[model samples]
Target: MKNVSADAINALKAQCRGEVLLRDDAGYEAARQIWNGMFDRLPGIIVRCVGTGDVIKAVNFGRDHELLISVKGGGHNSAGNAVCDDGLMIDLSLMRRVNVDPKKKTLRVDGGALLGDMDDESQLYGLAVSGGGIISHTGVGGLTLGGGFGWISRKHGLAIDNLISAEVVTSDGKLLTASAGENPELFWGLRGGGGNFGIVTSFVFKCVAIGPEVYSGLIVKKFEDAKEYIKFHRDYVRTLPDDMTVWMVVRHAPPLPFLPNEVHGKMVVVVPFVWLGNEAEGKAFIKPIQEATPSHGEAFGMNPWVGWQSGFDGLVGHGARNYWKSHHIKGLSDDCIDKIIAFGDTMPSPECEIFIPHMEGAPSHVPADETAFSYRETPFVLNIHTRWQNPSDDKRCIAWARDFHAATEPFAKGVYVNFLSEEGEGRVKEAYTEAVWERLVQVKQKYDPQNLFRMNQNIKP
Candidate 1:
């Protein structure tokens, strides 16, 4: 890309309603920082867009000036695609506004909105979207774009499956709306195609009926019983109904009151879940896990689903260096469970964890060709989340995750795109089938032929 002229830059600042920042600008540093601490790239320009109009100006400015471009929504992607060096960074953090229609059972969220922000607003009407990552502060744009899933996902499908429509600004600087009736192909690609098509300014989602509270929390067990517990969990989950979702975590026990002090900071298996039903039914549903293993600790109760979604926020908060390696497991073979426990026994950091999320039921019901998201047949996803402070521990934590991922590679068929880091194109291809990848490329060529939105898990035009 060619350098932007000073005169053109000044014109963009004058035209945009929001702030257009440069290197020496007061807020440039803060605007350019992303969730992943490892990336320290200094963008040449940063545009904090407050509304869709400002987004148009920024896109046009970058396009006309032939500058390298990047879009920063909530800046939570571990790959650091939200911001880049020597480029124009369009920061949408200020555009976080959510509007809910109770009559229609839908929500329209701005691109800059965080998952928690959406939840806070939507839950007021006893309506919810099947969204949010473990960290509530994650951006809605990236998460939904890459096939969102959570505790509720097993019951109601992924966020992309519930997405009804979206407003996007293409590389040509033209605003377009995508839905089933208009730009159908674009809508299909946007389901799990990442940010390659365009800058999505807003999303319209079909909400599900949910209460203020649900049965949710964790069941902790000692490391010694992990093998038997995993075996039981593997079989038990298959028998569970769609409304009950459970995932496993292997990590050192925190100083929560439920656990005995003797078990604090020791290896433990935690089974966290959300039951979308009455407390009586939930208790019965969760009883089998407790019976299967003599739990060292347990914490389960009826809680607010909206608030419970962000329960892991403090563990994976902002400014921590995070590297994640993940896979879509077909089934939990004895060998696979043993390998997971072997590496999890020696977790390198307190912040790191071995996450085994159940991805069955509702998400699998979506036909493979209906959306860009593949791997619908997958039952589980193992995320080796490596998060730690201190730049010195980066090598140690990252190596552990990679080695663990390699050990379990044979058991996985594909991968969940959202959990992937900056692995290359081969890994990206693994996230989709040949047909879906080709369809994405066609959509890319139609909307962003010049590849201006190549900062994400890119689909080449």
Candidate 2:
């Protein structure tokens, strides 16, 4: 078998233009590593694709060789579906380029480009497509496919909402483009659909005018004020207009200087917001949040969008152990708030945090079935993220997150597949309802009947 695999690798080398890393290659070790340390799969080969042509060759080679295949964009998936065991791993990291057409206010991005890269390039023109949150390092592929959320989401919608078109490579090793006018069914599936249908090489997105600078910052309140802060948040968020978006977290406060020493490692509601308007208007919009509750200390000010993008840099990263669970709730009822606060108070690790962000904005107004994102009507989404630095603490962190989700699932209206772990097909189907699930299955069959794009939160074709 080893000899046969080696011969197949040689055959691929002769047909491909880019480099391929076998098990013994130095690059193989690096290529196999994903954002989540929990996954440690050793693929037979890691093909670092330099272009769409290389991607096509790699896909066909893997299919012909009967090897399991995984497509990695930014390699940021918590489930580590980016690489597989004893299969062909197609790494798209080298295809990082962004072409922004300022005149059309549109941007074309290589699927491997990170949100940070997209923001950095787009912001130069005082324009930005909707992108994932600050950790800017998140790949465009995973984020966009799984319904991206970030600072500008309130104004523009999910990252998928801004996607105008995409160039995808199908299972048959053919390059195809999908948009509203062409391959419309495939286009709909690409948005929030996860990477279940094809390999997206390039995506064209409609850019919106936004920050060179924006009024965005954070406010921290003590642990004792968790309930009050949440209550105030619920009401305050309801009143805020579409131009403002805020996400509140109750967690052990990181020991930043602005955070009082006594408050570190204690539960607190870290309220972060980005107001998309003039300073005066933005300040007016945020005034009530400050007056509504007694905050521990505030980090409020005007900053560049990139600075605001970096605000959560301390929170998100690759290589850390990631176990994520999430819920989309219709509202923050008292029972739900109590459950959240209870878990918040007993957070198992400093890195363990609960996120509840309002979803009732212009972005949320879109029909649930319009795209692959089906939970927009869900008023709030809660994320229980358990992140730790050491493998020894893995079980503890995962148990804490799972328990939190189990306790709160009764109040949850739906689940966000992007933040989910490998819970199996039933859970995947639950992420979309019977009707939506049926449609997704049909679309999956249409574009990828062989299920070649099953590497993601797979919807079986």
Using Cα atoms with residue i matched to residue i, what is each candidate's TM-score against the true structure?
0.98, 0.97
**What lDDT tens digits, residue by residue, belong to model 1 across residues 55-118?**
9989888888777889888899888988988989999999999999999999999999999988
- Report the Cα lDDT for candidate 1: 0.89
Kindly list the per-residue Cα lDDT of model 2 for residues 85-193, writing each as its tens digit.
8878899998989999999999999988888888889889999887465577788998888888787787778888888899998888889999999898888888878
Residue pairs with backbone atoms closer than 3 Å in model 1 (clashes) = none
- Error at 202, model 2, angstroms: 0.4
RMSD of each: 1.2, 1.5
Where does model 1 exceed 4 Å of error? none
lDDT of each: 0.89, 0.83
